[model samples]
Target: MAILDIFVNFIQVSMPRSNVIILTDPASQFSMEKSSTTVLPIQGDYSRGNLMLQRIMSYITFLEQRLKEHPERLKCINHYIFTDSDIALVGNLGQIFEKYHDFHLALTFRNNKDQPLNSGFIAVRGTSDGILRAKAFLQEVLEVYSTKYMKASRMLGDQLALAWVVKSHLTFATKKFSRPEAFSGDINGKLVLFLPCLIYNWTPPEGAGQFHGMPLDVQVVHFKGSRKRLMLESWNLFNSTSNLSDMLCLILGSGRTKYDF
Candidate 1:
């Protein structure tokens, strides 16, 4: 869980203006009181490829219900995001939202054709239509999973399902990912934007070294697969912590759990 400490450090330093919501199962090992972010207990199996869809649907539903209950809250927020815990924010996320203010749903893409998109990082504008479009698009992904990917969706996790929807429904205006511009598109009638993984969802390269690090411009580092240790490594490389024990105090808030994943 030291990685979580590092995660919190990054947020507190780089994106202090942002809020984090951590959805966990009953068996999670994170301590809510020790954590600086909101730790929400969710009812579901935390395994991949389950009917819970890795709680993607649950998060979206939670936001939907919250806004329905407090309609005015929507006008006050600028952007809302959903991301996996295995990530570290390194750049100012607000800058991206400020520049691409028109997008309803923003997703990140990888180089692989088989798995072109990674669903770990998702950004939704806070505008009424933006939220509505995100809900509509994500809900449609559920339908697409059942109708298109079927068993494969469960086996490969939600990324496959999400990619299926993007390919089958959206029409892209630009395809280049290294142009410093978004791969803007339209899904049905809603606006969608695709950001390169190198910029927003960076993962380790095949032959990356122990000291490997991302480019200075990368907004986030997604510690996908078994690279969670790299998060702590990178954090230490960038920031000097004199008292490791004291710094670990600013962790995910109050309760204990059975497992870390």
Candidate 2:
């Protein structure tokens, strides 16, 4: 099976039973409207391959309407939004949410300094304040890009806009956002929480196992680059054996799953 097929199956099977919504393009072949899982339709102009920004905006708009309609059911609940490319390695989502429950918004960091925040995986509490802030952030990003000063690039898309929003609103001076337990200090008005990249959004170089060593605590593996074949090979190798050592050996021995970035 294709890597994307595997990814979809993983999401469909392992998704938490909470109110989970999968946002997809209107033209997509996959659509599920059921009790636990709801596949919402989103339409956007494909400009320079930056349709992700439009899809994200559509999701936020949908959430805003839902919040207006069902205010009581969404109270204090956690809403996790992930891209289609992200794969779930661990199944205990409640534990992860409990670990970062103090913050209104939780985002994973990209592997490098160039793209510090990866909007691919975002978790937001269902509180009124949390939803409001998240909606404001997304709206402001779109507004900024629409203005004359900022020109949106196809290479980065929503990632650049998100970074600008966080930097403009939040303060990262103290170690509060970086360390989970150090959140006792006053945030000085910042509502965003930065999760450890290794645990939440393990990427190529570190997650490939042979390169930087895959830590035992990796919860999600994000395949950001364009190489789908290698990602599938890696996923298959990781799931082929029960022993971690054997898995690593099988992955390293094949030499076909080497990640480029």
Candidate 3:
């Protein structure tokens, strides 16, 4: 349960508060530990076009507040991991944490040649030298890309801001720094090495139901989009496959998923 922060969008959805379904159900098993699991109820003014921008701003604000509350924990860890609620713990997470100890940033996947940047999952060591470099890069993004500062700058999005910053400033000293098993091949060009993901990816030439009766080879199947149905679908597929445990543990720790509250 070595975690830094928790952010959820449950509070903002327009539904009955009492009946509101949350993604928290999946993580009920891991909540009892002494991890710093802070659940963030969603903010009211966040809109789709600027949701990412607002979240980043909120993250910075929350980090500052936490520092004010617990000044001693500032240097305890380098960076914090921001995980999407839909993500699951398929195996032990120690391997990913180890990289955070060694590098300034980490993610389960790498950038492709054309779009060599995937910001879905990131580990940011706040104390590392990379932070200084990223500061300048982030500043450029704030000044140029953010609608708050620059109006005419139409870019792919804010995630790219982080991706371009990291890809430009950070250096991988070893092969182990990257998550080699996260993704196998090109989105539509190469054959994925492990389980063929129908959830996280929707690249063409192969899609959901692409391999109707074929066995899956991936370790963890990340349901990056359309989460609720994706998880159910993955679970159905997982139950049918006997060789999934070994593959899943590569990403999520072998322990069961848990929740705090």
Candidate 4:
């Protein structure tokens, strides 16, 4: 069994639950969701807009609780996959796992000046020591992210902390999957590739592009804003291929198995 987790902050006006559902629906094949699947809504003193680092830290804290509560779930799972709510799945991720059995951990490297790797898509699977290292890194992040007074700090929060810690602990088998040319699926038959276009189509500052012409192909459109508008738009234009309807229905409809905190 493999476990996958996604963190969605309730505070972000962009990429609301509706948008996230639309992005994920097409990728979902299992009639039954994973045993430990969950979305944690975190409410803290985080500011709006440039609070991504803070949100990530908060989500890390949330994961601490999830791990504590569901240790059994982790034991059954061979690999743990994490993707941002905004990212959509297009290709066969499960197939990638089958192809890349040797890789215990994987991530997409971001193109920062330091060329820091992106934490948006993360996979971890290995001995208990590896898990311990991941947790220790989280702890270290908490230490550096907080002030003596508990206010958030800007010191390379989640991405940097993760890059540094994971580098120390596990071996990264692939580069960041930001573009298709950089993606080489030859890693033990497993694949970890980024896209030039949006697998998770984030709303552009300009406007939506013509989905038909885009080359690399998009798995999911990560709409940071206009979730409702997009849903309504999807409803109005229901082509057989449109995933918007499915996503909107999931969000507008409800009956999730409520877990007791």
Residue 139 displacement in candidate 1 (angstroms): 0.6
Candidate number with greatest lDDT: 1
What order do you get sorting by TM-score, best first?
1, 2, 3, 4
Residues 1-261, candidate 2, lDDT per residue (tens digit)? 265555654454456455556666677768544456567776665454567656567757766875686666776466655554545444455565567667666677644544567767776666777677766656776765555223455556577766666655555622343443322112334366676667776554524454655556666666656445555765576556535455434433433355453
> What tens-digit string does per-residue lDDT give for candidate 1 at 1-261?
676666677777777877667777767756744345787777776665564375666766755765585667676876877877778776788876788767888989876666777888888888778888888888887676666665774555577778778877654422443254567788888788888887898765433233344455677877765566556655675676644333222111101211223
Candidate 1 lDDT at 220 equals: 80
True lDDT of residue 80, candidate 4: 46
Best model per TM-score: 1
Residues 1-261, candidate 4, lDDT per residue (tens digit)? 111222222111223322221122222343324233343445554554325455555545544544665566666544444555544343444444565554434555533434255555655443343344444544554554443313323334556554444344334422443343334222222333432333323222223332223224333333333343343333334334456445434332321212121
The Cα error of candidate 3 at residue 72, in Å, is 2.6
Higher-ranked by lDDT: 1 or 4: 1
Model 4 scores a TM of 0.46
lDDT measured at residue 26 in model 3 versus the true structure, 0 to 100: 27
Model 1 segments beyond 4 Å from truth? 27-30, 34-36, 48-52, 153-155, 171-180, 208-214, 241-261
Better of 2 and 4 by lDDT: 2
Question: Which whole-number lDDT from 0 to 100 does residue 138 have in model 2?
Answer: 65
Tens-digit lDDT track of model 3 for 164-254: 4434444441232243344322111212121112222222122433333322422233444333344444444554663445324322321
